[model samples]
Target chain A: MRVPRPNRAQLGAGALVLAALSVGRVVTEWLPEDPSPVRAFERTTTLDREVHLRYGNLRVTEVDGGKQLATSTSAMLSPGLWVTAHVDFTPTVDKVGPAYAELRDGEGRVLTRGSRNVLECKVINPGISGHCLVAFEVDPTALAGSHLALTVNVNDQRGDDMAVVDLGITPAQVATWKARTTPVELLMPKDAT
Target chain B: MAPVGMDGGTDSLRATGRWGRARQWLATLTVRQWLLAAFLLVLVGSSPFGGLRAQRAEATPTLSVGVEQTVAPVRLTVTKVRFGSDLGVPQAAKIDGRYVVVFAKVTGTDEKRSVPMYDALRDLLRIEQVPGVTKPFSTDPEPSSDDLRPDTILVADDAERMGDLAPGLTYTLAFVWRQAPGQPVPTSVRVAAYSHTFRQASIDDTYDWRDATRAAVGTFPATAYEKPAAS
Candidate 1:
């Protein structure tokens, strides 16, 4: 009868593997409930080192990678208007997930919840990047002449992980847009600003 | 049934193990694998990898809480200048082809989750604190006083086209908590009044929220309605 022979190399390898396995287990179990849903990503940012939040990539482009707006349309937005974000989600298998955007009011009130969806990719692949056309209506009644902030979440499934992006509403531009372009036929806010 | 069959079974098992490991690595990250190993380590108490991964898995199911706002104040910062040409009426008297985009972020630390981002925002904005002392700044403790709403908020001349305001430029906007009162104001502030100059425009800007970032202040700046002179 030959007893199972364990060489030093095998023994060392076994020990390392065991150690790694144990650490993983402890960490997972220890992570608090609802562990940080945000998956760390090393992408571009518009924030300084002090800022923990930044918009990675939520630029707008016509479908099929169309030309960007020649000049920013910062001067024409008015209160009570609808703006469509031709959001293009990516690389993830889900082209369209639970898509939605958030809007907060001057008083930290949530003015809107724009649903986000990977309109083109959910059913196809979980890792394939896709796009979603999210619709968000600007808040016309915020305490300030306009509201700020737009956060988006795109996911493949309901409970599965989600991709988030933060965007800041251009205030001066919004104000300028509101004052210059509002039409007459449509009763607009009284000339207050 | 025979020695030959037994040898074949052993070979198959070894092949299966190798394939499984490779596939697992592809699907998960190194840290994840390490975590798995550790959990299993603890789960089984010891198994080379100590089955730490298994142990962790068995420890407890994290309570996932989707952070978002069920109801929040009407906050939307978007600006686009619409010329009369865009509105098919140079003197359309209102903004017409304009677009403003808002951006925000949400972090989840709760135990259970569902649409965490939106949910958390809604919750935070809705049913604010009880001002005066524990909730002083609220001004009014009532619902209407706080301006908290669940659906979309609009501060336009009309409610029908609330989501589609007449395109125009030079209007006060909302900045829930992005920049601040005056410091770091938006890139450019439209200073014209009903001047149909630029049309079909979009402003890539953000609202004032420096105070919020500091977690020291509230009262974000937004486009307030400068009431009409009692027409």
Candidate 2:
């Protein structure tokens, strides 16, 4: 019995296959394992306009800021300005409210209600509007051109509806808010309108 | 030509090639030479994988009291160490044993988001050299189990439990450890501060500060236990 040697063409084909496999492996290794993309569906609206969410409707009725914020028991002073958003949530399907609320400044820095001593939105049944005040202690420099984001998804907001309300804060407004020395009262969340 | 003759000629030519001559030389090696060659090959191969490299352990920084240490996402300064029956906090009233309270000023360094104090500062300091205060899992025989975590962390001025630490705001925090009733009070306490890396978790790709490692160590003299003056 005789063993046959590989011909030039056969060797070339084998080398090509090996090179292709090596290139493919390198490309796949360089590719990201998890390319997490933004998945939230944002419904933007101006102040006093309602934005429809998947389970409810959100509206920023009023925006106020001052140097001091007075809670039910005591008042707290801020190193910077304290901006509070009076929000109204009307649930359409189930008992839901904005569990996640934050203030995003022009520089893209976010201040969430969890960071401040503020009241959270109370989840109410369908058909009635729930009123709540979401407060954020922000740097006075970041007060201008800041927006409020409210979402019902508490844990993860991916693939969910988020309400983005333009606070319409201007430089003059930020200056006025910073100059005000009086403490703004922080009210608790009301169950129904 | 006959098949056998052709095969013999091919074999002779192949044996004279570079690799074939090298193989013949290897076959002629004595046992000692072969062992030496094998060891040399292993030493050269292991060099790239760092197996033969010298272990260089980094010296942890020794920080003095009142000096600030930045451990990423937060800066901590051990301000004072005192022994007292009460920490001026509501929860301290119920805790009867003597408390070794360490007052530290913590400032959040992250500019973009608020860092939760529980996750960021809990493992930042470990209390050591305290009598009768055995660390959790101390009997496990693991070296890491020798770390004695703080009993509770609270806002120093307000006496409230610390929550999230906002950026650029400095808060004085009280890290308390309860001393056993019968054990003699320690004259001095050694404290270790840890550093952390902010990275995405393997389980859930969310980014967070993790992997706490000892960064600084300090020993402070324990003051005499004093009762608080009436507020």
Candidate 3:
């Protein structure tokens, strides 16, 4: 038995189909997964206003900065500016507190709270408000237009609720904070009246 | 048939030109000769750029003490090294043997995120000539060996553990190691600094700094620790 060979037009059609399949495969293989569409839900507010999260409500009662920070027994001098946020947290549904806290600068650089400063508010039961001070040692140059990000998730923030509070720090305030040499006393975290 | 240049000759005649010559030439070779020719072609193609020879790795640079060395995400400068029964830190009281303390100024170099000091700075420096000190081994089951790492990394001023380092902030850190008893205290010791590469992990796609390579080595003299006078 003899087999017929493909003609020129038939061969061209077959090659075109193979090329299209290869292009489709390349497109599917190289396309990136879009994680931005499922990013954390942000509740943005200014200082002194309460922002509701999925598990609790947070309010930044006060914001201050200085060149030195002092606790009850110990004090530390900052290499840069030290900004402290006084926050009041009241849980509604479940017992939750901000496990992850960071200061986001104007360039979007994040300065996380270090483990040395033990001033952050601990998790409390639902209803009663707990107050705490969260401190961040940030670069003096990155103080303008900074925001504080607080979340319940410790490691991963994807598909979770986050509270982004604007600190309302101006360039003038940054200049003054950078020049101040006095130490700011850090108060202990306690139950709010 | 028309002349060759007039209409490019007939199809069957053209087919007999190039393909016919190739077929005839292939038919003239013996099977052994054909195999030898194929082997020679592969050998020449595989070694296009001296691939058969071994490559020599460059030696790590030896830097002097107090010179800043970058190990990625942090720049370190070894300021001083001291040895004594009491190094003034709280851990010194608990340790049975003397403490070998190394003072360094560490600055965070990564701008986008804060780098945690936990085990990050421990893998960067290795002290030599310490008797019975646990050395870091890559094949060990533990991700990082605590025995080889510093017992504690404390801040020079407050004596607290140096935690996460923010960018552009320099911290005066004291890396403490308990000296193994029954060994003669050396007057000087060699310190090796390592560099790391930032890459995605194979198990999880998280990015981290890993694969430490010795970048710089230095020798520094150790001195007796003295308690600073109260202010």
Candidate 4:
């Protein structure tokens, strides 16, 4: 016939529990889905053709690497080889963000520019074309048929529109490059030749 | 039927008595006691949210212009602000309104590594037309007298000029902001440089611009403005 009322302390505790559950639920529901590191992206077999992206077109001219790492001042040795891609960017957007390179090997090993030494060229303006070198220091053995993924507007953190360039390096080509690897002089884009 | 009616009446009386007793209990507390109880309730109510946050000290002072402001690898100086109507620029280069050009110098202070000065510079340099709001305009929106690279903060190096700073180098750069159509040109403006950690996602791109250490380069009066003939 009678109902027992909860005291202030008990009511407050219940409210606190409810808020905690709500906050937890929102966090779980709103967090971005983790991208699969091994997931396949749209692949471009050729690099010279204009690869269209949301902001602009990119033409990756060359992708090369071996054991030798060279700078103007000195040459350094690495446990793995360096992979460099010379890319030309033509912007179509007003505020263009920076782009980074990722290297994925057949064994599912992935390496980003953050993980290795690199010299990058930035394309920030839309009025003129820009060139950048996105390099990654990766395991020399992984060079056999690895994919060099270039994602533009990387700072936007949207994580879409990646141009995956297949390195197309055969095991024999890797062997030849390894045997003939020479110390490369790190030069400015103008002095790259 | 008679017993059911009696039971219903008893239940109603019991509910009324319970509420009356609750109100009587509340009335017995003095004003000071009531205030204390209310404060305690608020404190307990906020405990879950408040307890989670670590207490932080006051924020760092904002950096001012005419002074060299350093944030780790990058050191910036905002030297001057100039306003122009036509700017003697090419027709294609002209904006819908006017141009407020800011001249600043950035140097890479770190000897160990080359700072991505362009990314930091873009994020740090801003024109404060109003007090708090910073307008986002395209940097070097159009072609100009100086041969400027679209992506670079530097003009194509002439016989005398050096471009964006390499490590241990200081380079002077200009940023151009356009006045919105129908908006009066700002008579007085403040140029500000922000200090932030050099992350791949740039300070401006990732965090709130206010959170960074803001250094006001300088405030300029109307006399500093320049007017050039439009093509």
Say which candidate scores most in TM-score.
Answer: 3
| Model 3 segments more than 4 A misplaced | A1-38, A117-119, A189-193, B1-53, B91-94, B134-147
lDDT of 3 by residue, A27-98 (tens): 978877442335789899999999988889999988888888887666777777888889899988888788
Pairs in steric clash, model 3: none
Q: Which stretches of candidate 4 lie over 4 Å from their true place?
A: A1-45, A95-98, A122-127, A152-154, A185-193, B1-231
TM-score between candidate 2 and the true structure: 0.75
lDDT of 1 by residue, B1-231 (tens): 223334557876777777777775666566667678878667776656654344543221111112222111222222331111112212222322221112222222211111222322332332122121112223222323133322222223322112212112112321121111222222222211100111222452222111111111122222322323655
lDDT per residue as tens, model 1, A1-193: 2235799999999999999999999997887643234343323222111112233223333211111111121222332444333443333332334344443333454433423111221222444434444333444333233222223353212333323333333555445434544321211113211
Compared with the true structure, all predictions reach lDDT values of 0.30, 0.75, 0.75, 0.55
Q: Which ten residues in a row have the lowest lDDT in candidate 4 chain B?
A: B155-164
Which 10 residues in a row give candidate 1 chain B its minimum summed lDDT?
B208-217
lDDT of 4 by residue, B1-231 (tens): 123234447876777777777876876777778779888898888898884357785664454545676755477766666655555434215445565666666676644333443444455566654321224434323323222211223221111122223343355665655654445556776666666653433433342212355534456553344543345
Model 1 score (lDDT) = 0.30
- Backbone clashes in model 2, listed as residue pairs: none
In CAPRI terms, model 2 is classed as acceptable
Instruction: State each candidate's clash count.
Output: 187, 0, 0, 3
Clashing pairs in 4: B63-B215, B65-B216, B65-B217
lDDT of 1 at B182: 21
How many angstroms is residue A6 displaced in model 4 relative to the true structure, after the best TM-score fit? 4.1
TM-score of chain A of 4: 0.68
TM-score for chain A, candidates 1 onward in order: 0.37, 0.79, 0.78, 0.68
Off by over 4 Å in 1: A1-84, A105-107, A114-129, A140-168, A180-193, B1-231
- Which lDDT value does model 1 have at A104? 36
Better of 2 and 3 by TM-score: 3
